[model samples]
Target: MTSFSPGRLGLRAKFAVIAVAALLLGGVAVGYTLRSTPEPSTGPAVTSDGPERRTTGPGGPRLMVLSNGVRSSVALRDPAGPREVSSQRCERVYAAADTVACLAPAGALEGPKLLVSDRHARARESVRLTGIPNRLRVSASGRMVSWTVFVGGDSYAGSSFSTRTGILDTEGGLRLDTLEDFRITREGKPYRAADANYWGVTFAADDNRFYATLSTDGHRYLVEGDLAARTVRTLADNVECPSLSPDGDRIAFKQAVDGDPAKGWRPAVLDLATLETSRLAEHRSMDDQPVWLDDRTIAYALQRPDGVNDVWSVPADGSGAARLLVPQANSPAPVA
Candidate 1:
């Protein structure tokens, strides 16, 4: 295993190392059936008159988040309001429909694991895994789940790290331990590379189509995938961490600044129909997978100087200023 220190690498090299590490590695997927268990809850209770009583307006939708590693949630209607925290700790988490996926925190003597649960926090399934969890996502239909982890090395300043990404079909009980097994087509021609890496997967509404980032050589590309066929085709270049809009017409992604990772990245939106890109109002470098709060709004985490992360939102059309949505929270996913 190799170790990388961000402080020793230049801005561009730091991101390059991270992007490369996030795209490499291969592994096996182990699956297990989980027995239902109650998860203890903390924080303010949602009483009938509380801010979380309704599912809209003053109560709006529920926004799942990781509060200092605890699985917590807040009402979108009152994002700054009290949160309902759970005892289940995770390094990364995401929720959709009835499914909630968590990358359980590693123990002193044990490695990290993936836990699948229901909306009420009832465990459904668990998978033993390796590496440090980085990203997690659930399909809109709750039938598919995916995750990414750093298998070797640490930080984003060096080329010593490797990444592994996996996907699971909850309904079919099929697992793809690594995207490397999938055939790839670049520029309408078969492509192969031992150093190819893939990560930041975002699924389509159909549950069969998906998208992810593929890094090889010195280039990064956005690849559209077909789960059943186990094939992926390059869609565009310099796109990373793509989050498809609810309408499926646009993709919210992180674009390497000026076609150079050393320069950092900017949050931007891509119109799938025209291949035109729209850079958001946020000028700061964001190293996150943007989530769609709705068809018109995109939200992502921004780390503050104090190392605390806050969820911020900007208009997907690139017309409005960025605004804080949730303070002291990250890995946001909207749930009803």
Candidate 2:
């Protein structure tokens, strides 16, 4: 693997980026562009670590996946801050800068409110199509939020994941589910695989299309879901829990092609322009989810096989070695 240093790139490499951006200046149709702009992953680390149940201090915001199954939020700024979610079983949680999003069990909701202000715990904001929000992602700009909600069963209905792309606006009218409602697979059966699980939803800097990792099996198979186009396609195999780049062109994910589940999931990246995946760092045991610290550096939680997990960051170009960022926390979530 080659280490890409923005400071040391040659003229030809710099020119290529400019050329790609120039062609991309005009609105190009979703799958028609000749080249994808190599975006810098300059944003908050996605799901840095799971939220700690017993949090301390005022240095950060904390989220709790409650026992009642609902995910609740508490701001450390105020020791007596109001709780965020009252009743949703928190399946997954992600924070984009200051705004945070989570997957909650539909049954945990007290009313029809789907969105809320992460700043103000009690305030109800916008609501989307009815269903249980099992996978959630917030954008870096906090202007767009998207989640996969299932409209079936009483709780975790065992339903396959469906796409719901949304844009947040100031007027606060009905949420924009899509730019234009379109279909992907024609005359197709709805995807409701028993184990068709969706995780790792992320927002690009532009907040246009969202990306997630969906899998039927953890071995040599992973599907990338395009939230805006209403399509799901194969991008990389043997990969799961992918986080998108801030500029939105490349992706950082974990792959376990060796079939060793414990040591299988290691940090990797896919350059969209070339459709090439570079494995940056691989631990003997499975590493936790990986997120881009910048276009060139990635930070992730790594555990000693079946041991504890801690946060670490390394250059994406694969030059600099992985450096420990923080000590082991049950689940760590980093704020930008």
Candidate 3:
């Protein structure tokens, strides 16, 4: 197994991306069931140490990360005044509307665990997963939670890069282990491809309508998904990891260049109405699905030369320079 790193884009990061591709390739979608895992004793429900303090105020939400790569916490511009959110060490976290979802590996051979908690970082529920978790997301209202993981196997992802993506309806108690069952339409025609894979889900304001990346037959598509209908239709091609803007009009995503995925992808934004795509400020290969800092800016984790991770933000319009937001941060989720 490749070792995972927050700051380095080494074999581990390459395998992570390959695993995501395998996930969409139907490598682990046969008769699998999605269920929550028991809360690990290492998790936090309440702390007798004292009440948690407010880390951010009217300025907006603070950035959430695994502080020191060991403790789950949130911080302002700097890591100072870091407020502990959970005791369990999280590999990734997504927070919105007072809801925080943490994805942490259970063991070297076992799959990861998903911990749902309040804004205060108190545990609410825990879900056992079947793979190493990669991406984590929560809807603006926190009613919809989605996750992507690498499900290793011999049949897919040459290097055991198989992946599995799932969604949990927190309010309705419904779980879709894999989008494999969802009906799909490609190029405006009813399509049925056994190799199809879906991931990187971004919910709309209504939640019922969402967007995600669907890959099949060696091609990737930006798909508009309907939870109610359990259906997804291709909206555009070459887009992966679609993150809807806070205003709901634009999406931050990665676009594969020259129709060659192996060449790597560039960060860009797409307008839903006009279908206009604008490249972001960054020039390096971005393996992340960027998070919108607000309606105007986007933030993502970047690896420094010394293997230290930092959160950097850039204007969504492709006009400004990328600026560092927090040093030593891996997953940068807004406090909203």
Please give, for residues 103-138, the per-residue lDDT of candidate 1 as tens digits.
997899989999998776677778888988988989
Q: By TM-score, who's the top model here?
A: 1
Better of 1 and 3 by lDDT: 1
Displacement of the residue 131 alpha carbon in candidate 1, Å: 0.8
lDDT of 2 by residue, 91-194 (tens): 44555554555544344555333454553343335564565554455677755565555444332212334434344542234365532232222124334343
**How high is the CA lDDT of each candidate model?**
0.83, 0.50, 0.74
Candidate 1 lDDT score at position 212: 94
Cα miss at 253, model 2 (Å)? 0.2
Runs of candidate 1 exceeding 4 Å displacement: 1-57, 155-159
Better of 1 and 2 by TM-score: 1
Candidate 3 per-residue C-alpha lDDT over 1-336 given as tens digits, one digit per residue, 9 for 90 to 100: 989666677888789888898887664453231122212122231222222345332234566665444434444544434344434567777888867788876876766798887865566778999766778889999889999886764222222245678898888889888998899989899999877767788999897898998878877889999999999999888888899999999999987777665676778999999888999998866667789988999888777678677767889999988886665667777774
